[model samples]
Target: MKIIGFKINNYKSIGSTENFLSVEPKVTALIGKNESGKSNILEAVGKLSFDRPLSSSYLNNKNRGASGEVSIIVHLEYYQSELNEFEISQANTSISFTDNRVVKIEGGLSELLNDDELLMEAIQCVLEMNIRSVWGNDSNRIKSVQDYLNGLKAITSQVYINHSARLGNLKNWITNDYTSKEDLIEKLEIIDNCLTKYYSLLPSVYYREQYPQLEASYKYDDIKNIFKEPNHIFNRFLLAAGITEQEIVEAFEDPIDGNRKTVRNRIARKIQKNIEAEFNEFYNQEKIEFQVEFESRVFKIYILTDDKAMNLSERSNGLRWYISIFVDVLSREYKNKSLVYLLDEPGVYLHVNAQKQLLELFLRLAERDNQVIYTTHSPYMIDSRDITNVRAIEKVEGGNTKVFKSAYNQNLSNDSKMETLSPLVQAIGADLKFNIGPSTSNNNLITEGITDYMYMNAMINYLAIDSALNIIPSAGVSNINRIVSILIGWGCEFKILLDYDKAGYNEYDVLVNKLDETLEDKILFVSCNEEVVKEKMWSNPQTIESLISKDDFKKLSTPYDGSSSSKKLAAKEFHDKVVNKEIQLENETVSNFQTLFEAIEIQKHNIAIVRD
Candidate 1:
């Protein structure tokens, strides 16, 4: 089985996240500031255990007056399947066995939502009726993942007709009377037996923050630390690779050439090859030749790079971290079953490019039957190209943590948006080129064309209004969708500013039709993240040109050019006058533009562009 997602709620800084934080099949990154609850999230997922209960500290939320039960759960797929792609194909089985038609959840309290009910019922039905499975302890079996994925697919389908109405408050049902959060705890134990076969097969999660450095020369006595927990990660790594005290002792007693068929040399060669391969592939820092020695119980490890040879301790922390994680992660694979690696600020010590290299290493580690979930503040660590795996975490001062699956969360308060979505500026900004040079700020405003852009700029400049939006002029109203798509791709924080009139409303409806809720909601709100912009300013149908008074527009217009050309010339003239302080804009014109600007400010205009 594979972990497709994890959810954390009612923990230290986190509240009930609306949905499961989906993980890309390979690797995932939890990104935010230092105290934004990113590290807490990693720790929570790592703490999932069958035998242990949460500490008393976990239940304490006196700070935020949090009274809800903690409900953190992970969704495991028997086999990874895309939405609507999994088919319920049962395996043909003839073995006579128990007729029990349950998948463990029969032991827990019910009244589950329709989706959960169908999911469990479907799994149980398949487990009872049609499974050619490998039965383990307590009759827990390894049935085909097809049945499991089909159950999830039922709820995750693209076709809207397949969805059920929000029947009831899921929170109420889940916590109706779950005494001391037993129901939530039961979920972990229940899945341990029936639903999560592959999850159960793995050993306990190995979480780490303090990575031990590689030792150049180990004393004979240091071998005793091999089986130790977290503190001796480098030793644990070596142990996982089947290197032993016995082999080291023999090497000391009987030294031989590396090409010989000796146990020590073979071990040395393997370690040398793996260290070099792992380092070279992931770390973009100076390339080095490994000095892997098994000549004695005092085994030596060294690296020669940049024409200088140095022991592991003499290297930079970043280099040590890179090599250490390489050995540490690979060692986990030697345990026979896959394990989740909860890494904390993995590349914090690395520079920009080196941090990016660490991300690549993590991707390699996750693809090998293991899952890697890391937390970081650096944008270099996040892959915006395919961001399904990225979860932006935020915590307002003295507020519960809010985890957003998408950067475009309308629910985010303005401060939260600036805090959580800021990393995306450099991450996505560098990836795409724009027709216009963007203002240093990211609160972009997409306009229909140059005339609207010029007029808005002029108005803002003249009024001396501290407008936060850096207006971006698109080719026309019809071309807005293409720019919107690009902004969405970059995960940019922006708004669409169009003429609030009939033609604009029709195009808005067209946008509403073209993109689904997930895509459209990020960029297609009516006005400034649903803040009903400019409603009282004018009741008549109007264009951006209407923002200026009729007499002022007539004063600026020319008889030489056509209508469109005339508007462009008029807009330029007004902009020059505003910039040079040559003309004082009328009170009505100033009020009209300020009304629109205030609406944009209040909501940050994710969508408001339309034309008449």
Candidate 2:
């Protein structure tokens, strides 16, 4: 079974999620700021029991159900061969359920309820539970089922109204002729155990802030026995590190009749060499060597450094944490076709460079058919080589988690796409290039977004205005700070143009007094809102498009008849015409743009005086 997606509802701060929150088959990087419910998301996914977690505290405080219900849905894909094998196993196993306990099931049941074959297959699971009850408490096999069916038919409204069909089906399944007990059990087992058996194939989820500690040394006698216990801390770590029980056992054996200790030493050396080879593939701070030695019947680990061997305790906390995650990550790699890793703010103790190395490890694991969904505020952890797989969780109204993924919507406003990229705080959050345009310009005009770039660039060329300002498209008004940071980092001088609306007016204060007071004169507000907007019959003009007349706006609207179209695409089309000088415009539109350019020159002169 493979996890394809999950949906959550009424879980803590999460009121409800997307209809289906699709998960990437390989690594998924979920980015958001602190207290944005990023960690809560990972916690929900990591604690996904083979069934599901039940915690009253997990339910939302408000707008929750009377039962304080929390709903979680995990969608899985099962191979035909695996499903066949699971059905075969369930039929041969014996089970009993005569305690009269109510049975409950949840998640992804609508499909089964809709399909007749699937509904019958699911009904068999309930049927098999009743038939298996005959073996409970050594009761008479036939009478136990008969009494159960009789009781199911009598004295119970639930069984009669709900299960009269179950009684009718019982008559068809249980024949009058006596049969061997094994034969009856075999007949009952043919019903299918898709739900239970699917759970068996699922990989167990393990979530932790600190990895289980590995002992420095262990007695060879105890090590052999302890290795048999899969859940033993030491055994788990060793297994995750690719150590095998058979290898450990063989290490202590004298197969050729040589000294036992000498034979053990030879095999131990090979194991140590393999550990070093695997560990070093992702860590490059230094060339590390592992030394596993057996002396006086005790096995001890030593870390080799600079030609000196040191005890494992002598290593840095960062290195120790890395080793713990490395082994645990690779533990299931060889056994399962795919794995889900929910790492919550991984590499907290590691420095920037060390965190970079840790991210490399995650990428390497993802390549081996594992999916890593980790939460992080750090940009270094995000693999931005592709932005489509990234998802952002932001706290919205009523403190609920809202995912900003409308960036992919074809007709969404530029603001929607910008909101999705906000959580990717740095230049690397989206498919943005930080070092390209800014480096080529000495003095720059950073607009609120690409909308300004497309329209303004076309107008400047159309008016034949001589200008040296390099117009750059920012992420959006909300991301002005990040744009400022990028420009400051590149040692570039720039001015920002803000719209005359709420977000823009408030951003000036946020940028100057709050972010950096030095930018007081570097910020400029739109001049068209007063002169052009009030004079025109158009309801309101907040952008450069407002400077264009209605006839021109309709001209760029493309098809001249479509009610909805991508504004960005339309802007590009207008820009192409203006650049080719194949289009003519109204005198008012030309005058409006000229007035805005003249105002910019005056603003630049005013800022220059203050600087001097």
Candidate 3:
């Protein structure tokens, strides 16, 4: 299943936001600067699904009257079969089902939308039924809401990793309510007694105390000794109900061995041991491992550290930042559940290479159908290729927060692809090329043909003039308007250089006001200096008696005297003469137009002239 869409509101820095998650990408990166709502997106997922704390402190939103709430809605899609049963083979003619019977259930995977009731059922079903066999049999597959929930359980909680603070709360809860080891052995004995109560003949079999004392495995004596009236078990109940530890101790006498003040230390150890055992079982199914080393004692997967290995508490902020998170992630993965990971500025102290490696690991997790959302200020963690995914998060003027994509949104131009890795200027250059803008700092020198563009560049280099002004040649007069609109939009400096006759003036008239309005300060109108222009090259003179004479203009209008290749050669010859000082070119800027050809002489290449 894949999440298709998401919507959220009033969550931390996010006033409201909506998005569509990309599909099965090798990688999807969220790009945004610090506090740009990227973390808010992650938090919304955590808040809705994982039962995370929604306090002012957690979200830095103390001013919302401490009553703010976050909401998230997600859309998902997946493949489903047409049968309602766990497996319904199409080949079974007798058990035929229509298409309406098949559906692909989608789990609302966002943590923001804590909809897990159906998911629980799905889990129960998967546990009880032979899912793999059913799936393999081309069996009747039903798209039950429970199936979606089950799918979510597999995906969302696989590695629901969070930083230390969140882990701290989860550990406290799990230790207090579920994995408390003392409770495990006590509960086991309770089960035994309950069994004995049901079957009179099995009373001997249910007698735990009658068994021999054993040190290496679970102990029947330890179980009986734990719940001996008014012991830690009772105190644990009182503690859970909000009684203070001191009050619980005062009210209860030690039922075990009849000691009063010696509280149950073994219970804590027992709980820890039970958790390890549960972890082992979970890992056996999930193919993961969880281990840890504590400073106080050797426990499950113990790692004993020497005094030399331990650092002073005052100087261990770096270690503190990572150690707990590392443990939490491994533990969760070991439990064999898919999880949406939340990381708040992870690697605040790690080396750059380590951060990069961490990001690589995050990618691997994502590839395996887990979601990892994190916030960080380190540039090293930014996947340059995923920069397009960055959303600029900001607080608006009306005290509302907003998230917006950067001007560098991927759709802007192909050049935007380079923005992630290339230098700013080089990326800008590519952008301009793709956008086809004319003149950045000064008025653009627009020309009538590619020949003119080549000549202009050659001229600039020949004159050895350093200028930021850019020149782009319109493929033809028809494209001048388009080039003008873009140049105007960019508000760049520019100049128009059309041929000196009717077509030139017409294009200038149509574009001059456009440039004036959009790029007023930067635009300049520079016509070809009539006197210095090549009289022999004029294509269509407006008057009967013009520079090269009416007879020459009439001849120019006639069909070309040779093949398209020969015409191209003639055009090249004219350009070379203009650059060589053999043919006197026009004005000061026209002087520049001639040099582009001189810079890199257009090599001998075939040119196709339009047949008249």
Best by TM-score: 2
Candidate 2 lDDT, 1-612, residue by residue in tens = 456566665565666554235566566776655676776677666655543334444433323422334656566554335547434321111111111232132332223222335434434443455454433433465554556444333221111222334333543445444344454444334322332333345445556545555566788899878967876666755665556676666655546535655556655555465456777877888877777776766778777878898877788877877776776666656564456788887887676567778878877876665667777666556543234456666665456676543223323334334454454434332223533244344457777765567677787777655566566556567778777877777677778887766667667668877888998677765654433222231344265665677776666646223232555556656776677675777766776766776666633332211111
TM-scores, in order shown?
0.52, 0.55, 0.33
lDDT of 1: 0.56
Candidate 2: which stretches are off by over 4 Å? 1-4, 17-22, 51-68, 76-204, 213-215, 218-233, 241-259, 262-274, 305-307, 396-399, 406-423, 427-474, 477-485, 492-612
Candidate 1 at 300: error in angstroms? 2.3
Instruction: Please give the distance, in angstroms, between residue 209's alpha carbon in candidate 3 and its true position after superposition.
Output: 46
TM-score, candidate number 1: 0.52
By the lDDT metric, which is better: model 1 or model 2?
2
**Lowest lDDT block of 10, candidate 3:** 202-211
**Deviation of model 1 at 8, angstroms:** 2.8
- Candidate 2 lDDT score at position 208: 54
For candidate 1, lDDT tens digit of each residue in 1-612? 356566665667777645256665567777766687877777776765422344455444322546566555555543323112333332211111111121121101111212354345543443342222212222222232333434333422211111112111111233333343443334323332332332233234678867776666776566656534444765655654566656655565554555233866667676666566666766656778776664445767778898788877888887777777777776776655567788997877777777777777777777666788888766677764334355777776556676765454445566666556555534544234421224345577777665676677776666655555666555458767776776766767777775665556555656667754453443432233343234432354456777677656656645213365466557657776676576766766776776777666644353223211
Which window of 10 residues has the lowest lDDT sum in candidate 2?
A: 90-99
With candidate 1 superimposed using the best TM-score fit, by how many Å does residue 483's alpha carbon deviate from the native?
A: 12
Ranking by TM-score: 2, 1, 3
